[model samples]
Target: MAMAVAAGCGGGSDSGDGDTVKIGLLASLSGTYEAVGTEQRKGFELYLDTHDNKLGGQKVELSVGDEGDGPPTAVPAATKLVKKDKVDVLTGIVANGSYKAVLPLVEQAKIPLVSSNGRPEVKNVDRLWHTAFLSDEPGAAIAEHVKEEVDGPVYAIGPDYQGGYDELRGFTETFKKAGGKLANPDGKTKWTPFPKTTNFMPYFADIAKSGAKAVYCFYAGKAAIDFAKQYAQSDVADLPLYTAFVTEGSVLPAQGKAAKGIYSVLNYSADLDNEANRKFVADWSAKHDTPPTTYAMASYDAASVLDKAIAEASKGGKEVTPDTINKAIDGLGKIESPRGSWEFGKTHSPVQKWYLRQVRPDGKQLANVMVQDLATLGD
Candidate 1:
């Protein structure tokens, strides 16, 4: 699902020639998260171009690494960037597994990793800073809306991993905290392990027997499109579908009308109503070949944070260290996020607003439209 490129740190983008800083851009440029990676890469490049790459009179070089499929690729790739390439800051990851895999390597090397994926537990890990919100938490964003509007027994089918669980936990926990219960919040969530299958027949069959009235899920990439298409072909589609971090730009377009009317919790939607949002959507689409997604937006933010940080860090500094650079990023405080406001956590995660979005078709094209704004899923 992911590919890896083991890089050896050699030089920064600047090479100290004329005031340029060298940093690493780690993401699944190939394999599973490729769809996400391509978009993020474009967004990152856009930031560099928009900022003119000379932040605070220094040039920023991005050493790109591909976190292919999962951690196996991500870990070694990160080693290359840190040990071989000699980059100062490392950031961007489309998959949570890659984050889990390369985190220790970055920590061991004392390099900083600012992530694009929202894996909440990452906050507990060392060196793995969260630039993006822990989007996998479903309840934190839309649980209240689900309980108030989705009245009845709710079933869940998640990815069965930290990211999946984080989203399910948020949905079920938030709903339960508001006096509602899913079919089995305490039970194993009904989901397929990401590596367990290429086909989803058995899973759909299992969903048919779960006795659930409505089902909530948080699978992304190909899995999301497949799940929605399969549900449409099975008894499960007869029930409403609710998911978080799934029904968005890349996945929704692929699902076609099979994804129509499904509910999801997210941080940004291509259809968010605001000047910044409108400009972002227009600029992103104009610049890229694909529709805009929350992944693109958050990844763009991650890159923007780095640009701002580098700009500030160079104010009185020369060689950019990850810690000093990260501090600069955090201190930049509230820059104009396309999604509105964004704040960094001490853990490198974000304290930001989330949203409830739904899949809808504008003519033949599919899009994720905002249904609600869910403020940070934390206490």
Candidate 2:
């Protein structure tokens, strides 16, 4: 994997005393989750750019490393950031697998690790908090929507991994609870080779044979792009597709017309009617020339949370140490985010509204438009 380091030195004050707060970010800069990592990095960096790269009136330095696709590479990267770079805190993990690999070292160092994309609720480790959506949250919300709106058999498909299991399980359990049934419970409801498969035609063929009225799916990055395009060209293209993280933001731009009319439940939407989101999209568009994705919003929120915590810690004229930062974050009741106002749950995941969105034309470009305000689902 490749590693890149960028210090936010120019915008913030050059106190020149070596007192810059170092924030280590571990993300997939290459491999399967690179697009996710790129957007996440931009979101975090955008916050710094807008704020003049200062947090709590202190200069901030960001040290970034590619976590690749798994823990083998991430563990060493995290270790280097903590032991060698002596970073004050850690943030930005794209894959849950990477999070699992590097978490032990983070706990040992006792530094606060704020997750931007990693599923935080799944791991019970201390010194870690999630500023991103729980992996199953969007699934649960979609389940609730399906139970209330759709009828007949519902089928599910996802990359065969722990996250895929969690996503599908989250949907199935809630859908059953709300009185929905699977098309084939005992018959291959789950599938695999998550980061391995590129061609999903076989999966789509199986979905067609399942005789389900609706289908729920979860795929991101290149896989998501291919699935949307291929699904649109498939026999079941007209079937109402309900999904979580299956469409929106980065993926939506690529999916384009193929993604039109697809419904999804997620925490952040570019079309959200709120002051914070309006400003976020406007500023993000001005800076990146692209609409912000949920991944970006998550990392952006991570930065916001860190800024608030650091500012709170500075009230006493104290340096923003790990403990002080954590305490400050703990004291915070709610964060006004681009997604909306949300509070960190007991599990460190955000308890926020899950928006039901549909891919549709938004004047010049295709985008995920808010269809309805779905239920809040998180730990």
Candidate 3:
């Protein structure tokens, strides 16, 4: 496909030298996480559409790469974006592995890398901004809740990857600190399926017989869908299920009835009470024919960050360059986000609110209803 070019003029628009701020988006457009990648892209596009496709008075161009779900494909795609496409800025990662692979290139180029979705294990990097939550924050938040609510051991499971391992560590460490014990402290109950796992019956059977009070899991995209459906159909369906990133946004639309009553932790919810969230939900639905997912929310926030930085960089008719944009973001304080107001922390990841939500019916659609706002639970 051709590069997505948004041309318009106003305020500090790209004018002299025929400059355009090209944003390179890396996502798994055709892999298991396609739903997630699509939602993120939609969110960024929605922001541009509402702003008439202009950032800081300059026109914007989005170049996309189908980075699949891992780094082997992602590194090359990101390399092409930076080396050949010569994009001015980079964003829109959907997986941790892909983010790790492409980060060195961005750091070497000194181009601002705004991560829209991937929540890597590392924190604090120069010229890199994480508009999304870290991989561990939601897991830690859930662990805190699990400690207070669940009376017995909490079992854990995740896909076997960097994201999975990071999320588990987040939950386990925090849960232990809160005096919670693992179902199998020897790590016997912890399960890690291959990345492309579709059949979850075997795992569910193990979980059913594991004699755990509740289960803590980290799964996203297609894997999340399959696991939720299989768990709901299994004998252990009645047990309390808690997870991070498993029951929100694009995952829910596909999960449908199986998603009901699942307690999850996230920064944004469809039913989060706030003016910004209310307006964002309505606007996104009107444009996309669906409610905005957390992935979408992150992408929208990334776009907003870019818009603010670009506007600052273009001040006094100054040419917008990578260095200028980086400086603008570095100086940025709190961003008024749809999830809520948040600011970049010392680690460049968002220090934002974490909501404990339960999936329930809201009229004809399933929505994540906020149980409580566990405010600002990130590094």
> In lDDT terms, which candidate is top?
3
Q: Model 3, range 1-379, lDDT digits (tens) per residue?
A: 3236654222222335457788888877878788888888888888888887887778887788888878988999999888777778888888888888888888877788898885776644877888888887888877877999999888888888888887888889989898998875576336666676788888777777777899899888888999889889998798899988788767787898999999988888877778888888888978777678889999989999999998998888887888888889988898998898999988888988888999899889887788997656755
Question: What are the lDDT figures for the candidates, one per model?
Answer: 0.68, 0.79, 0.82
> Candidate 3: where are CA atoms >4 Å away?
1-3, 6-18
Q: Candidate 2 at 238: error in angstroms?
A: 1.4
Q: Could you tell me the TM-score of candidate 3?
A: 0.94
Model 1 C-alpha lDDT per residue in residues 201-249, reported as the tens digit of each score: 7776776776667877777777777878888888677788887756665
TM-score for each model: 0.88, 0.93, 0.94
Model 1: lDDT of residue 137: 53
The sequence of per-residue lDDT tens digits that candidate 2 reaches over residues 146-244 is: 977777888888888766777777788888888888876564465747777877778777778888888888887777888898889988898899887
Candidate 2 similarity to native, TM-score: 0.93
Give stretches of model 1 more than 4 Å off: 1-18, 122-128, 184-186, 316-319
> Candidate 1's C-alpha lDDT?
0.68
Q: Which candidate comes out best when scored by TM-score?
A: 3
Tell me which residue pairs clash in candidate 2. 160-192
Sorting all predicted structures by TM-score, with the top scorer first, yields: 3, 2, 1
The C-alpha RMSD in Å for every predicted model, in order, reads 4.0, 3.4, 2.7
